[model samples]
Target: MKLSSSAYLRAAVSLCSLLAWTAGAHAESVERAPDAPNAAAPDAAETAEVSGDIIVTAQRRDEKLQSVPIAISALTSDTLSGRGVVTLSSISQVAPSLNVKSYPASGDTLSLNMRGQGIADSGQITKDGGVGLYIDGFYIARPQGVLFDVGDPERVEVLRGPQGTLYGRNTTGGAINIITKKPSGEFGGRVSATYGSRDFVRGTASIDLPAIGNIAVRGTIAYTDKPGWVKNQGGNNRYHDFGQLAGRVAARWTPSADVTVDYAYARGRVTTTPAYFVNPSFVGSLPGYVATRDQTWTALPLPESESNFVDHQLTGQFDVSDFLTIRSLSAYRGSTSHQFVNYSVALTAPTFPVGLTGQEDYRSKQYSQEFQLIGEIGDRFSYTGGLFYARETGRHDKLQDQFLIPFNRHVISTRWVEAKSTSYAAYLQGTITPPVLDDRMKLTLGARYTSDKRSATRNSLVNGNPVEVNARNSQSFENFSPAATLAMQWTPNILTYVKVSKGYKAGGSSEAAPVFANTFNPEKITSYEAGLKSQFFDNAVTFNVTAFHNVFNDLQIDFVTDPANPAVVSTINAGKAHVNGFEVDLTIKPSSNFSVRAAYSYLDPKVKQVLAPAGTIFDRLRNPASPFSVGDDVTRYFTLPFAPTNALSVSGDWTFLQFGENELSFHANYSYEDAVYTIATAGPAVRGRDLHASEPLERVDLRLTWATQLINDRRARLSFFANNVFDNRAAQFTIAGGSPLTGYVRQAAPYSEPRVLGIEANIEF
Candidate 1:
């Protein structure tokens, strides 16, 4: 599955040549529909061209996706539906250089990594992700609640490579922008229902009310319930089973031609069974290892977990003149989660009949406000300036109890953490098209100054007695991120750009067992990139390519000290790293009957140095288990976690029949990802057990649909889909636990879902 650099280049060249050949004879021009739901509808005269463009708001303005200087992947609602993308985790199949993993026990908890850059630990609330996630221009503060069902969105845009100056801090890798459908002035609604394997049932409804005077309103709701795929041999319970409900309401008012206001509210809830642990066969000689058949496992008990969140946002915009505008955005978001689990199955000695239980309660709240002024000077210069402020507060409370039934010995421990943070920033960006080279060359410059202050308090108790090894700490960080780009339009259909940018992520206190394990230094990255975007044969084909190199400094690494005390997690500042990669995206639409889309990514990442403090867990763990020596500077080379060496996706859609407004279509897609490591440092000696790298992933999805307006003046469609057609059981996560000295090394892994078949029906009126 490993591909060389030369192989990738050859593939790109071959694909481009094929596209040019297929589209060279076509002469039709296509007009794209606007991404904004409230934007003016397209004219009927421009609807039959067969080549449809996609509009994106990646640069804070509406433009064709092909015209954007940055490397971006944009998916519309119809595309998402066709691909059967239900959650954030499935986005990787369509987007290059993106990976997502979720804790099997809690579906709401997940991690998103792009180009080998992401948070090291999902359990730590203080840590921030390398990729920024935005919903309607509002940033999501935490990763736990990012996996919720998106319902239906107007479009989703994935911007790659250090969007620092515009996106602010914590976007060293990239950014994801989700834009939802706005309220329309017309009265309309849609309803959809789905049934699938594993007793899966899903229903969704959306309604738009006719405008009353200057106001319009819309509402949407979605619900899903399904049975778990993994069976529990010892009981009737199943792991990873869940039910979820989500709702959203939006309102828009245009009191005058020059001014407009918008408001939205959203809420979601999830309830699920905890994950089940499967003991590894390699450790079967140990007393704790329980042999199992297939992927089924024996569990003495099952745990329960729940999570919920609410979001509110308000926005206003005023058009002062034809070339000037002012906009403001305000938002608030809150979430709470609870989980109760039995840990003995995965962490305690089986022969001793140990019973270990733990409970966790977490809550978080965040508020943000932003204001911006956008102006255009003639046809030469365009600029935007913005100010932003955000505040966040959260608390985590956890309790653990251990019992030895044979010895009648019991122990209890509790830890509590409270944190608060405030952030401020001001940013400005401008693009200038000089009166040279027929005004085809442009220069862009941008900068942002950001300041962040954070404070936290940690408390602990042992067996009902207070422990003094806890304290309070505070820290502040400030940085200036700048960006520059030079772009040229060689022809009316070809554009090229080169960019250099800086990205920053603030440091914060850790919620570990020891009081002194409080904080880590900030992380930063400087990146350089060059790209080409082109359209050929009257816009029948589009091809884009990008090459980038990034230098990362002071990376934050999270590791566990002792599995016996599972809460003893620590964070350290690793010295430096380097990442270089190339990406290719292609789309071909020779005629109205067929289209093809393909993307590929190549990533090469290496850690340049490691600096672990003496007497720390990192230093102690590396003594004999890791490649590092005791006193030889302790530097080693390794790839970042979740970074696959190569990845690819190819999809096609064909419409074969059309009669009397009835059409039949077929879609199929294939995705492949090379093998990857799930942890920063993984080896057999480190955990006193043999460890295996993650298996390469391969998946194919297929869909068939029939559409018609034959149902009483309402549009109706029925579709059938099969995901993971080959049923590949690739592992997504791996963890090691238990005491190494006891000759007991327990390992747990969570695999991707098996094949799923479903049927869906949709109707619009």
Candidate 2:
């Protein structure tokens, strides 16, 4: 839907007016309380002193979450453990406006979408998504290892909207910051073990050593083994089974009062069977198809997949003076993955096989460096400036074999791709509190200049003979992103802000077989946002709301050009898109023993214009059964992929009993997402049929915990948790697989995880 500029302006004004009136009325009522004289006046710290208050570094500085002008969701270690969230897939249940999906062939590959912005195909190595992922302030260069198990972290912060001004490249959608626990000066440790459904078992351990001559050390290790949720009738092996092991070591040195140094190393390995695929039974028109059965596959030729990665980081901080600080961060990372799959369900003839077998291997290495300076001037101005540099190199090797049973024909294709990139950026941001309005108004401005150079080469072989399918290509891009925010504190417990920002994602070469279609233009977004943060009822209730509108130019889109040869995918600069959304987050602590949290989001995304490629067979095809046709604009007026119109999450925790240092608590949460289209198309018409889409997702989780004192003043806790309690059988991803020439098109989909119940035990010393 298209929204006029005047309409948005009016809505923003109305929202601000309502917030102002509400804040004034609340303040007046508080002042008129009978015990107002005895109660201390609420200050910045006092107004945010509730249990819901959290410290965040969203703007590259330490501040209260209510004080940050941007929209963000922070998940602490306690919250993660309580929710049984171990990976990014489960994180979406609690984070509104975020969705994560894996490919049908491989579960390790993840596509992350936030606020209608994300890459449709995450398998493209050369192209980066609009959202950025960071671990310990260092960027993760690839999506392959994004699902690695993160041993207990201090917190995970999800920043929504454009963050390019401070975070630099590829943050048009937003950023995810994973902050691990740092070494403490005192000795501490924890151990945990879990046993769940499907014979799943997991164990984790951590240890921290006391300061030794101004140095402290900490280490953690975790391991998990689980059987597949799906049963295979064709082979003895199961699909989607996995085993993983991960470890991390960190050390901190504080030899002087003003100097500090920290170093960390992490490594992990995972081995799992590829996800199983089955023909869609719901389509009754197709011959020999049956619905109403569990996810079972009759054919399995390949079952092994592996992924591994190692990361190292070193950081240093120096207090130049009371008003200035300098920090340096350096990191290096490497990863490798191997995937094998067989995508055929049945045999078409006695002497021939109708199936496809594929094998792929990927390896990557990267190094990055960053330096920053932060200063405060006379309590009126604070500024942060940084310089960043990163270099990455990677290789991808893929082989595919297709067999036609009826004709007894076989075809083999192989592709080897190599890529390298270098990026440099400089950014600066400053916040000033004006003398007017008693320092209640603040102005923030920031900008970043980025330069990137990337090159890639692809060599293809058909039936064991080399072919010049695509030529080597090199490209360079430069971008400037700017941000400005105006914020005012209307009351001690209320703050409102308006912000405008620009974000950019660098373009890169495509691996398509066509020699002439090797490059795409950069994607950019201009965003405007307004938000309000307020607290009432003596800091027991906190509410935050934000509305945003974004305009995207030269948006990059990836899709299959030909269904017959499904191995090669094409990338194009589709056109412009307009996205507008609103989000609400609320926390209420009705009593000391009970609390509730809820989040909701509404999004409307539409393609405003598009330029189609001429002379394409798929575009010009006049078949009524085809999704595209002659004179059709493939992208115009189409809804963006992975965008859900409405999403909601509600959670409540109740502590029913507490007796002499022992406590018992119950927690439950519910999450819902509207139906979403997995692929982008014009009005869902492909081949005169409806496009593939995912069903609405609804899930509920419950947890019960008991805690008591252990020996030697230590503590011990036990918990029982259940996820997807209702066993919702929703599809995570769906697509068309079989060739259309067979007189029947086959639909394939991979379902989400089933219900799981587990028990966990933890001991702290």
**Which clashing pairs does model 1 show?**
none
Candidate 2 lDDT over 241-280, as tens digits, reads 7666678888888778788888999987766666665555
Per-residue alpha-carbon lDDT of candidate 1 for residues 649-755, written as tens digits (9 for 90 to 100): 99999998999989999999999998776666542333443332566899999999999984334588899999898888775565555433232255566667789
Prediction 1 global C-alpha lDDT = 0.74
User: What's the CA RMSD for each of the models?
Assistant: 9.8, 12.2
lDDT per model vs. reference: 0.74, 0.75
Segments of candidate 1 deviating more than 4 angstroms: 1-51, 147-151, 234-237, 282-296, 347-357, 402-410, 468-470, 562-567, 618-632, 683-692, 711-713, 737-746
User: How many pairs of residues in model 1 come into backbone collision?
Assistant: 0
> Model 2's lDDT to the true fold?
0.75
